[model samples]
Target: MPYSRRAAVYDVEYTEERDVGFILGLVGQAAPSVLEVPCGAGRLSLRIAPYAGRLTVVDLEPEMVARTVAALEREGHGGRIRGRVADMRELRLEERFDLALIPREALQLLPPEEGRQALAAAAAHVAPGGRLAVDLATFLPVPGGAPDPDYYDPARTDGVWATDWIRTLSDGSQLVRQSAQHHDGMSIRFDLQYRVLQGGRVAEDWAAGMRLHRYSRGWIDDARPDGMAVEAVHGDYDGSDFTGDSPRLIALYRRGPAAGR
Candidate 1:
């Protein structure tokens, strides 16, 4: 995702609609020090700034970090916000946090192995009795899978959530073609395109493409790494108990004292 353009308009595009009130309420109850990975625009950080004892906001893009820093400065909370540009898989924070968050399915952007690595990294940062929270987007299979929207109704979904994409690549022996999406409101107008290549030659062209992941309870059960223990899983931000078919996977994992070297 080329985010330079998005970085400029990110706040207007999403900050207001981020549901910080709900997140803050959760943070208040948890009262956990936080390290928010991929903390885009620092919207959540700023919202939870006063409540958290310490916060370290990180993003892969420098511009995003700059934008978040600017927002923090504008809000007079620059002293409380520590902004950095770091890869989720290669996290390098020295201090342990009571809570480490990877919200908005930021984990989905990584390959499965990287996701596991991040889980380990996050676990390494959790102090004894600390918790780790992350969201999974049950919306679609990631990396190389198409979205299936038969379960969703655009008119009733309530929000400007939608997606569409196309990809075409034909090699002499291998052919790859896919078009998938779920569009709503103004999303219908946005489309992504890709170039098709075959045997290193131009074969054709293609065009292409979460709510909290709608992972099942079993999925969460399976996500437990070796050193973490599952505390509770929520279906949504409201703290509903996770069901097997829940549309969102809100998970909290605690790092056992045995974890970490």
Candidate 2:
């Protein structure tokens, strides 16, 4: 989960334009205190901070945290936003927040057990009756039951070429590869290989395996900690109802009255 190098070009690959509005709308008009876990490059944090009474963001990668802080400073929110480096599974924040978020499938990067633990840690930081929102990619099998071929294209910026592909293993796990080449002959590539575990052994391979988990409502239900109740599920940022064919799964949970008070 080291995002040091990826942090350089993350925003280029993943833009916030599509999600920012929906997320902000979900924050409501209450000016609630906020906590963001795995706030890589501050894509959402920077925008959300303005709407929050207070904002605290944490990421495991120091480089990402630094980038987030720098971005906030550039936007004149340095004093308003707090950025820190911390592990989600072992989070130890002293205070709770009215809203806690683990957006962009950040929790999916961890293995199953650790993912559950991370959810619990996030739940612990949510004040009673507060809400925790988590976004996950829908767990749908690739169409046609075959891996897609690699795609090559020129990067948005001049003088760069990029290629991307996925390999689906027989057991349903995936291996994804993204590579970029500069006109000057400099190149960098990364692979996210995932293997399905059955009885603690590799069952198969799948795409974007390292960063994405094939998540479902049952998965979240299984990971729910004590005193937490699933409140809503959305198919996308628009607050649409979740369905089997939805591309993303957004779950909202409320902390029980007696929990995390």
Q: Best-fitting candidate, measured by TM-score?
A: 2
The alpha-carbon RMSD values of the candidates against the true structure, listed in the order shown, are 11.2, 12.7
lDDT of the candidates, in the order given: 0.63, 0.70
Task: Point out the worst 10-residue segment of candidate 2 by lDDT.
Answer: 146-155
In model 1, the worst 10-residue window by lDDT is 164-173
1-261 per-residue lDDT for model 2 (tens digits):
444755654544445456678778767735378899988888898789778878899998888889888988888887778887899999998988988999866776676678899999998998888888888765443354321111223323433434454444344544344443222222222234334455556655443313334556687788887788988888767788888876667888888889532
The regions of model 2 sitting more than 4 angstroms off are 29-31, 139-211
Off by over 4 Å in 1: 15-19, 30-32, 140-219
TM-score on alpha carbons, each prediction: 0.69, 0.72
lDDT string for model 1 (10-103, tens) is 4543434334655676677665578888888776777778888778888888988998888778878777778888888888888888788887
